[model samples]
Target: MKTFLNKVLVAYFAMTAGLILLNEPGYAYLWAGQGGTDVYIVHSGKDKEEKSALKKALGGDFKVKFYNVDLLALADYSGKQKAIIKLEKARIVIFIKDAPHELLEGSTLNTKVIIFNSGKDALKSKVKTFYLVDKTIAPPGGNTVRASSGSELNKAEAIRNADAVVVDGALDIYKAAALVVAALL
Candidate 1:
């Protein structure tokens, strides 16, 4: 019995150590990138196009990272906490469509947050909030600007409340990327 217990303990310790090593921030940095991420994107993992567009739009100027988290997974407290930790580390956090508003719960004041197709329940935070709207949807009753193309987005000033900045859905991904890049600037 003593020998069996010792073997079980050794296996448990090995598993724990492996898990710790896999989750270490240094390990992630080494694999993902060498420096801190400038933009951290959390999305539903359904749209590959959106991810590619954002990356292209950001270009080589910024170090961006993407997290493909399932909305249902975030329902768990531990899962939500882990997502929040990553969110807080970013200079800017962009929540693509279907990403839960709950992930914004614990973000720091310095972090800038942008949400595309944000739901009405989006919690107000100390961090700067920018909401991207689809041109087809009605404006959510605040400062809004109509930007159909990248050039239009570049010309338009920040919406007074930044509550809504409309982007044409009919446009190509590059146009959408331009709008997002404009928001990030």
Candidate 2:
């Protein structure tokens, strides 16, 4: 009975340790680049699929470093402050969803901003260049692998021709980000 109890206890501890390791890692990520420029991506939180898509688009380009941070905690004062500090270091800043208004209150003359599915409030940001994702490259009805845009303004050629590139419903964030990044390259 004693030996059986000991074995059971050991198993319990092992299971607990395994569970801890299985937990997902933090959202903060820094992908090193060889180039002098840095690209900062601020989003709500981690999305495995989106990250994978972005990585596929990177194609070993060591020139641009990718820094991703989650603003899910932005309601807290500390979280907001931390995000501002991080944003200040970026040469290119991409804001997905509703980024805090405070982010645009400072000097953005040298920074390039890419906005996706954001509201008119984002227009207030003063950046060197602004790129918006009007729609995704994916086709409608969720039945095809091909990419298409609902509006003429959102097409790949349009994105390339406009002031900058821009997304909307049915478009995966990862795919959209990949498209914009690819266009920039």
Candidate 3:
């Protein structure tokens, strides 16, 4: 009985320690790309808690346009393709995962991306909620990005300057830590 109790304590400590490890800078946010460059992926549903949590995850200001993708109602790839194309250009893309992977993967989006999945589609197209960011930031110019349909310009600027962003929920703490590391690198 003592041995079993010891094992339980060790497991509890291990889990607690693991949670603290993943909350670093780049490791915390939604996607794997730079704040201003890559597309942003956040899983905030309407007025969900994750929305505020996602904002908290970013190191700086984070204003983004939110959209809900009714995966159940969505049909066909063309609409998905168009949406993906649209997201790739914006500084951040916050939407549900109703669109097809082919459409998303094929879009000309090297920008930051934020995706929200209902613990579903977590493993897809070799990219899970991890926001498999295989893109890079283009040369930084004083070039002002087209203002996203969010809040004020000043507020948006601050979010753009953010260092890290969170994609998943607190349960995916490990991924968040990884995001911090990736962003700093």
Candidate 4:
């Protein structure tokens, strides 16, 4: 009985230690690429069309990749640790759905955090949330463009031309990506 109890205690401690280790940072190698800017998008994999649009929006300047961070095995974790591990290599981290609040936990992470909002309640936190809208399906009056809308490529120049007028709630992936690039630039 004594030996069994000792083994159980050891196992418990080991598991605890492992969990602690999982929370530490430095996991950039996961986003391996040939050498362009790396952008990581943490999505739920349900929005196939939106995902494709986002990729199309990315110019040659970025190596865009999508990751479904909410796996059953890692369900217990807030996913902030996973974000931290790959934070170093990622130029920007975009949250399509299920934004990991853990990323904003403790000290601020060096990578940028973008939360894509599609009529969902915004996070109470002050972090940037890009409003998104589906232009083809929505009722009239609201501004939303189709995913393949051939808007001008010069979002930054347009933004500048607007005299600093900030546009909110992007219509499609192209516009969203343009907004992100503008912010980064």
Question: Best candidate, TM-score-wise?
Answer: 1
Q: Give a tens-digit lDDT track for model 3, residues 32-51.
A: 44344333443324435654
Per-residue lDDT, model 3, residue 127, is 21
Instruction: Encode model 4's per-residue lDDT on 1-185: one tens digit a residue.
Output: 99999999999999899757754555344334446457776666565666666777776567777776445335556555555556545666665643333333342445554545333332221332333334322222223323334253245454223211123344454565656555554
Model 2, C-alpha of 18: deviation from truth (Å):
43
TM-scores for all candidates? 0.63, 0.45, 0.33, 0.48
Model 1 C-alpha lDDT per residue in residues 1-185, reported as the tens digit of each score = 99999999999999999878977976775456456677877776675777777778777877788887676464666776667676667777777765555554544445777666654435333666666657655644666666665455554345434556777745553455455544564
For candidate 3, the 10 contiguous residues with the lowest summed lDDT are: 126-135
**Which residue ranges in model 1 land beyond 4 Å of their true spot?**
1-34, 71-76, 102-110, 155-161, 169-185
In Å, residue 173's CA in model 2 sits off its true spot by 7.9
In angstroms, how far off is 160's CA in candidate 4? 9.6
Please provide, for model 2 over 81-109, each residue's C-alpha lDDT reduced to its tens digit, 9 standing for 90 to 100. Answer: 45555664666666554543334433343
Q: By the lDDT metric, which is better: model 1 or model 4?
A: 1
- The alpha-carbon lDDT assigned to residue 34 of candidate 2 equals 27
Error of 4 at 15 (Å): 24
TM-score of 3: 0.33
Task: Identify the superior model by TM-score, candidate 1 or candidate 4.
Answer: 1
